[model samples]
Target: MKKILTLSLLFIGLHTYAQKAKLELNLQKDSTYLLSVAADMDIDQLLNGAHQLVKTTVTGTTAHKVTAIKDTLYEMEVTYKKLGMHIQMGDKEMGFSSEAGADDLMSKVIKIMINKPFIITMSKRGQIVEVKNIDSLFSGMAKEFPQVGELQLTQIMAQMKQSFGEKSIKGNLQETFVIFPKAPVSVTGMWTTLTTMDAAAISVKTLTKYTLDAITDKYYQVSGAAVITPDKVPAFKQSNGYFMRLTQATGNYTAKLKIDKTTGWVTESHITKNISATMQAKKTATGPVELSYPMKIAMKFTGSDK
Candidate 1:
């Protein structure tokens, strides 16, 4: 369990950071950044080959869990241009390309898990590339999968503007986002695109009417918890604004951000997410994941030369 322990510690730190992850860079203000990243991802591929491996480790497995957990290594490269982030397929990709047979595999699944690994690098304009991060990516799954919609970055940003108004992004603005399954807590990865690719919807409400926090000469923090309406609570509440947080509640989480004072750019980022959930057992299963912290992300941005 040494690996698990190491991963747990690393993830713990990262998750906490992600809970309040930084939006910093080492480059100059208003510059585009590109980061190279690799990771040790713990994934449960839909049909990880070793049926026997499936037989050994997991207990109380589900058809979907079995279907989802495919033992494998994931690989990928990233390039950030403009304000957009793009991922170029990794080595270990999970989920069936199409949805037709996805449910069929969901039947035999009991329990599924995977550990993903990757490498990360950073660079500035005409600067030498520096390696940034490399570690394990962990994930787990049980049963139920509710269909949720996929939010588009455009829609998300648009919503941000609609709710919060336009500001000159004076400081660093960094973020990571994820979605869960609709039925309860069955979402491992994105299962559906509620809106068309052209019309993808982002969680504007999550980023709405938000106030920015003061920045230290070293770093500053902005929180979504304060700006959101109570109805937006993802788990506990289910209305339109359920996910929105209360106002001025930055005390709830911490985001360790590192900034380059000379140029007001972020150098590196470490995010760790921790969550506590309360659930009541249902007749056939468990209660909804009354979640605290959700899919936390840690990202490092660097300016690009070539």
Candidate 2:
């Protein structure tokens, strides 16, 4: 009877240990990983009482090659392998893909982005330290489109910079890879992280609570819930001579992730976010108009080590 009791205690101890994990990036030099990310967004706008809905989908795949490791930081060379976008509004539809022929201006620009390599420096805890060569790369791409008018080219470059700039890249990387706790955590353990999404026209701050849901032999399942609040709302001048400014914004975010136990990398993730905002349009002929904008975004990400 004593022997059976001892064996039972040992089993419990083993199970407890298995439920705890120290999640940190354990990337090796010379190793490579492929990451695919996709996002679908739907925006419903009531502008001056007229309603419109727009849908957009963006997809990209990139390869991250660990070139060097210094202390707790990893230096990686990242190259875009594929990129595509599709947008639909009412009866109009537009799309572009790097794999497709460069038949249109947007497609030509996307083709130029493929295979361009940049460097990222990140800590084991998934803090992005530096993003290098992205600005220069974009500048080079601008030079390739000489046929475009200076004004149109400037607008295009501005939009690209706003989306793929250093700060934006850091924000995106942190959102995905910075889910680990500072110390080891067991199943049901919770931690919080504050992150920001800063863009040219708007900024949002998110406070997320992450819980370790389950631990398996090969991976850990984690879930997160966040409250998103507007940090900054900048007035944007529309092409039609009106200025649009967001007056009120609130949102909620949720995510589920599967992280590799060995490498601490996210193998799969799904995120859903909903935002409701009020905007005011000024300088219109009929005077100031209030607009209601509600947006929903869904994202999926997958990564595999090669």
| TM-score (C-alpha, index-matched) for candidate 1 | 0.23
Give the alpha carbon lDDT tens digit for every residue of 1-306 in model 2.
999999999999878856668988899899988788888888777755677788888888888999999999999999888889999999999998888664888787777878888999989988788889996546566578778888887766666666677767877888888787898888888998888766544567888999999888899899999898888765453433455655456788889988888888788888887777765666664565644454444334344442
TM-score each candidate: 0.23, 0.86
Backbone clashes in candidate 1 total: 73
Question: Candidate 1 residues 1-306, lDDT tens each?
Answer: 999999999998666444432232223322343332222212222223321111111111001001111122111222221121112234432331112234432221211111122222222211112212221211222212223223432343333333222111100112321111122111111122111000111121222112234344554433222121112222121223333222111112223334443433334433322222221122222344333222212222222122
Clashing residue pairs found in predicted model 2: none
Q: Give the residue spans of candidate 2 off by over 4 A.
A: 1-14, 17-19, 232-247, 280-306
Q: Please list the C-alpha lDDT of all candidates, in the order they appear.
A: 0.25, 0.78
